[model samples]
Target chain A: MKNTFLNKKNLTWLILGVAFFFLIQLLIQVGVITPYYRVTMYWICLFAILGVSLNVIIGVTGQFSLGHAGFMSIGAYSAAVVLRSMPNLTGLFIGMAIGALISLFVSMVVAIPTLRLKGDYLAIATLGVGEIIRIVILNMKITNGASGISNIPYLISWPLMFFFVFVSIMFSANFKNSAIGRACISIKEDEIASEAMGINTTKYKVMAFMFGALIASLAGALYATTYYVIKPETFGINNSINILVIVVFGGMGSLTGSAVAAIVLGIINNVFQPLAEWRMIIYALALIVIMIFRPQGLLGTSEASLKTIFSLDTYKNALKGLIDLVTLKKFRVAAASTGKGKQR
Target chain B: MLEFLQQMINGLSIGSIYALIALGYTMVYGIIKLINFAHGDMYMIGAYVGMISVTTFKLPFVLALPATMIVTGVLGVVIERIAYRPLRKSTRVAALITAIGVSFFLQNAVSRIMGAKIYTFPPVLDNRTFMFYGLRFNTQQIAIFVTAILLMILLQVIVKKTKVGRAMRSVAVDQDAAKLMGVNVDRTISLTFAIGSSLAAAAGILVGIYYNTINPLMGFAPGLKAFVAAVFGGIGIIPGAMIGGFAIGLIETMVSGYGSTLYKDAVVYVILILVLIIKPSGLLGKNRKEKV
Candidate 1:
């Protein structure tokens, strides 16, 4: 395998990411970002990590898992247990390690049997598993049942969250470009064809699922530590759907898309926090509109790169399209009409 | 023994409502192969419509029930036309995502309009208890049971003996072939939605009268449970949905009665997973091997 980390493009992006992190840290130190907004930033990082990780299973591997919150809760609770006793950075890392191990075990057990089911059946089965996990947590004594675990010392700092999010994005992006990711993608495109090619579809699928579970667990640990209180209700089907919305809204299979969408949606949510009722209404409408108009999502599995951003041809094509729109071009109208006619 | 009998009766009553909702899920899944996650919200709309008819319009129970069914039935058709039909040629995942979006839209829209408060459904039926074979029965339970059975019978007659039923069956089997045979595939699918949604609406009204409370979010749990019933009975199989609904109802009641109530929901989900693992096609679903 090529050295993905040492490449010129990767190095430049890595430097840019660190520079951006420092800029954010500077802003926080200067009192520009309030505590409330900082919490929202934490959520954005959490969701970005979740979305990127989930994209591996649902996007790269062609598996529809609706039980992500199940793995997340396992991580949150396990980490909460450890942190409740220790309440330090070392405790946080230990808790995260423990959470990842548990999630690894659980994902293996779940993915082995459930991965055999196809499409909607898999979705429903995962949903059932997620709900079952939540219910069990709700009834557990150590988790405090429905009341949830409270007074967890807030150990997750902004830089720590940024580090985890950066790690998750890099890991998933690398996975997508690797041979195993190619095998998983082949399975997604056509399972029988991949199997004919002698790929171990089930094994790769299980691997991707385990990877997703591990990262999701890490995010869960971060979530528990950042929020100071972890509730079973926080990891319900709705939470799973919220993470799903992030992944889907960002083009599936595109790590950049997941991160972009997480940040955009996170900001939208925070901006509309006061108009809580209208916020969900608008969100639902946006989902529907996006599905109808752009089913491929925001980036459509394509990465946004510096070369593409800086290429003159890109700007020229965009300018041409804009000019066409302004000039009421007949060809554009004709093309649209023809497309509609084809639908009929 | 007497308590068991009473629980059995209670289970049957609740099971019938679940059956009504499950029929809608099974029918929609049969035609388009989409899970129609929004079907549950249709039930919630039905309950609200029924509540409004009784309280504001002062319609009697008999009249309000049909009114609710008609309104929600039409709404179902409109939703299919607007949200689902446009995505007919897209990937199944896109359609599924759209369905989830529709579900959220319905839930949030209702909550926004209705203020998310739990409205007390006016007592539309008489409240009376009677002893039957050393078991206590309430008038509302008997009424819900009887009405659900009648609706199921009516559905059976329509499906088996009517031309629209034949169209639905053929469309379910193969939409393109049915279209080639001049089946008006779109209309048939719409009709299926209408029928399924109407059944769910009737269940909603019955539930409202039974529980004496209605809310914007009340349909989520029952909708999921009914979906489990539909899958358990064999998704896309009419009879399977009915049997699955009642079976889930009975199992849930039995679990709550003998075990802890907290675990009842968990037990239902466990059953769903077990059925998916042991028999993905469900109890009555025919196992068809994948050609590819």
Candidate 2:
């Protein structure tokens, strides 16, 4: 009877979570929201989706990709070109879905041959692919050459965006709590050990890449349909880097960290409009500072959870505040005594 | 046949500029694994510095050449000290992203200072042509090819013969071991950037002369192509970049001349894809044993 009551309480929390998002959707539909806040929320949702997609590769898999924008470019242009040829609303939805699917297919074809390559080579291969995509699109008559394709489909509405964003975040959260997520983290922690332990590192690596590419393509499709325009330059290295920055700035291996980072960076981007030209400089400085002072990121490798907030307070009090403890802290203190962190 | 020769000449000349810039990527990638995305912007800076030195300071061309190299070299070392040195122990991916950030900062700062408009460099090269069998080699083109080869030889000698070069190779081979051996990894890295930047400076001045104009963002295309070249020649190998540079030049020029020039990047991208799929270690790079 007590267990049944506990299960009922968990069901209520899940329903409440659904209701909270439902309320936000209702507010938008009822026209109680301003366009400014509405647009910002829309971008935040889109980026949050993209950030989680990126987490599969950068955060969990422990690999770097400067080519994510290239995958996105594929989706954006895929949607743009297809919907133009087939403009029925259902056809457009099919196009967005197909566009994302095709991207997964192509990335798999590319990833299959190249994921086996050594460290940083994969990064370069991906980067090269990204550039190739942009350059090829730039020259394509279908893309209007340098002029870019316009009028994709303004048919994408706020409700659609919110629904897709919720689906995206939920998928990522669920992945974090699943076997696939554990497999990715295992590969990241030690590939050799994981392989020795029969984890099939290569399969996990390719799956992670495919999954990341799939989500990124979905984000690209959503962005394309909503904006009703797509330019090759729009999905350049800067887009990939921005996604990466959000991933790292949150926490490299944490899903919730990326969502929070995307939101913060999005707001920062909007607020710091005056620093447009100096944006890279600020980001570079921030990265350097973060690596020096807090390389673990704000959340570390741990995902954010309701219980984590309370655990954090206790952990802080038990270790540093209350009394000294053994373990890595003692080693760190010993290293400090030996003159670590003191520059010559 | 004459037209083919002309394309060859044209490609080799442009290839020289790419080769020169690629030396930076290959050399630094050789010692330190940092991609140094800002290396391209340093080329931009070199152009601006050339503009300032030749036009603003009113110096002779040859003197201004050395002057641009000096200033850009110092700037390269300073960036290493500031942005990268502290993050030395972090993951290579973090360093790569940071390099991109540094790149953005440099490009934007120059963009802000010089404005985004294209600025034409005053004609310092004599810009005359020598014709042979219907193929004409411009003074600038000849200069570019000759100077690039000379720089490659100089780089080869530096890496192969000098004590500093030995130290650099040592650090590249094993940073922790080199540090324990008292090789001063930081200083070697700075020197690597110094030499790399000087080469980029030379490429900048030549390209400025060839194009007769320089823009703030001019660094992006060439920078990327140089990176392509470095990879093509098998990164971390000195002679490979030289060959890769010329190879890229030939492909891009041939494609631009015969096919649609707009698809020039398509040629590079295809090569990149082919190289990665067929030979991940590159044509010249030997496979490294997995580090424990």
Candidate 3:
């Protein structure tokens, strides 16, 4: 464990991450990053955290969960209720903890039964669970019904948001490389084979699901603290799909991809803000186009590590791909027809 | 007791609409194993078309229903050709996501074109109420039930006795084998989509006339409920979808009548989870052991 943490590559990444964080903080202090942009940054970080956590379930564990926004609502509401009375950093922590606990419990209740189903069935089941959560919240008195809860103190800062984003990405990356993650992947590849090999499929699936729910709740807390109000409408199926889009666009299994996609998509959202009415239409079209052209996603399960980013071979391959695209040479090759074959 | 009977009648009308939509879901799933998330949006389009035909084109009610079905059916075929056919060999999740994208696209596009305001469907059918044994029934309710049953019966005949129906069945059973036997797999799939979409369109018209209000987002809730019905009956089974639809309709009506109206949606979802847990294969589905 010590060797893994103290390795040269790990040390370099840590330094880079800290340096980047400080750089962003310095920019915020200097007023170079305006308040408007800061809000956008907060959203990017929240989406990044959400995408990474959901990646643990969908990409790493190979389970299709569409109820992420439900868990997020739990955190947001719990935090809002707690902070309504306490309105302090300690209260924030307490609220986040409560949210995580509730999400964990709900996820356990949902995952154990639903995980036995596969693919579209699981997706629909989770979607139903999410809708049910939203409906319950909608009818609840404490949530103020459809009007939602307001007067929430904006306690979450840029640093706190960034810290949580970093922690979530780090945790997801480490989990992906761990034994449990491998077990989850094995189950994803073939549940029966993994079960035959003595891996407890249900236990690993439940663990991954719980982990996802926990992180989603934390992000939810951050989200609630950033905004002044929390509404049940915000945590509907559409919001869940929004997070799923980030994960899928980033490349499912890659944490780095999720973060990058979140930032990119967040910027796209900002750019399209003027055309608010057409935003969803364009977003839907983009989803269909991307699925048709590159179903594996932007990175295609490959992480953008320092080694790959800095390597000459990586750029060379990219150049070759570009040339191939322009020349239509790739399409002409019969042997290269399969979509998955071209990923590597 | 009279109120209970009234609720049951109401349930039957609503359940018939659900059955019509569920048939589309089941037929598509039978052929491609996809949930076709956008299937519900087709219902919305159908409603809009029905409204346009009746209000703008000034078509009679009898003619408007067929016009709506034909338009939605063609759109379904076009959607299948453009979005789904390419992803037929891809991952189920990919196809599912694309279906969702299509659904969102359809909803937003229609909303943009039609505006978000709720439009009152023209009361083509006379609002005549019939009373029998202290039970009240409306003409619209009777029309919806009768139209839905006629469509289902027509669908049954087509699927059971026609050449295209045979092709669809064979394709669903084994695509490659059917292809080997000279079945046009692509065309068969397209036809399946067409037929399924038309049924959903009929339901949409029935709903518009029955409810008296139509909106761009109207298809979402009913679509979900219909999907639940499809699963409850056995996702790919025809009779199963029909049975499931009526059962869900009755349950929903009964819940709202007896319990809080707010909990009706929640109750339907709970039923979905319970069905999934208790018998994932559904009421009429045959359990096939997973193969290695």
lDDT of each candidate versus the true structure: 0.87, 0.78, 0.89
Q: What are the chain A TM-scores of the candidates, in order?
A: 0.89, 0.83, 0.92
Worst lDDT run of 10 residues, candidate 3 chain A, spans A335-344
Where is model 1 more than 4 Å wrong at Cα? A312-344
Question: How large is the interface RMSD of each prediction?
Answer: 5.9, 6.8, 4.5
What are the per-residue Cα lDDT tens digits for candidate 1 across B2-92? 8898889989999999999999999999988999889888999999999999999999998998998999999999999988887776667
* Stretches > 4 Å off in candidate 2: A1-13, A26-32, A82-89, A309-344, B176-182
**What are the candidates' individual DockQ scores?**
0.49, 0.38, 0.52
* TM-score winner, 1 or 2: 1
- TM, every model: 0.94, 0.90, 0.96
Tens digits of per-residue lDDT, candidate 1, A55-122, equal 99998898998899999999999999998889899898999999999899989998899899887778
Q: Could you give the TM-score of chain B for each candidate, in order?
A: 0.99, 0.96, 0.99
Give the alpha carbon lDDT tens digit for every residue of A1-344 in model 3. 36457888788888999999999999999999999999899999999999999989998888999999999999999999999999999999999999999999999999999888888889999999999999999999988999999989999787788789888888888888889989998887778899999999999999999999999999999999999889998999889989988988877787887888899899988888899899889878867766666665667688888888889876675455435434534332412243343110
Tens digits of per-residue lDDT, candidate 2, B26-88, equal: 988888777878888899899999988998899877798889999999999998887777666
Task: Give the candidates in order of TM-score, highest first.
Answer: 3, 1, 2
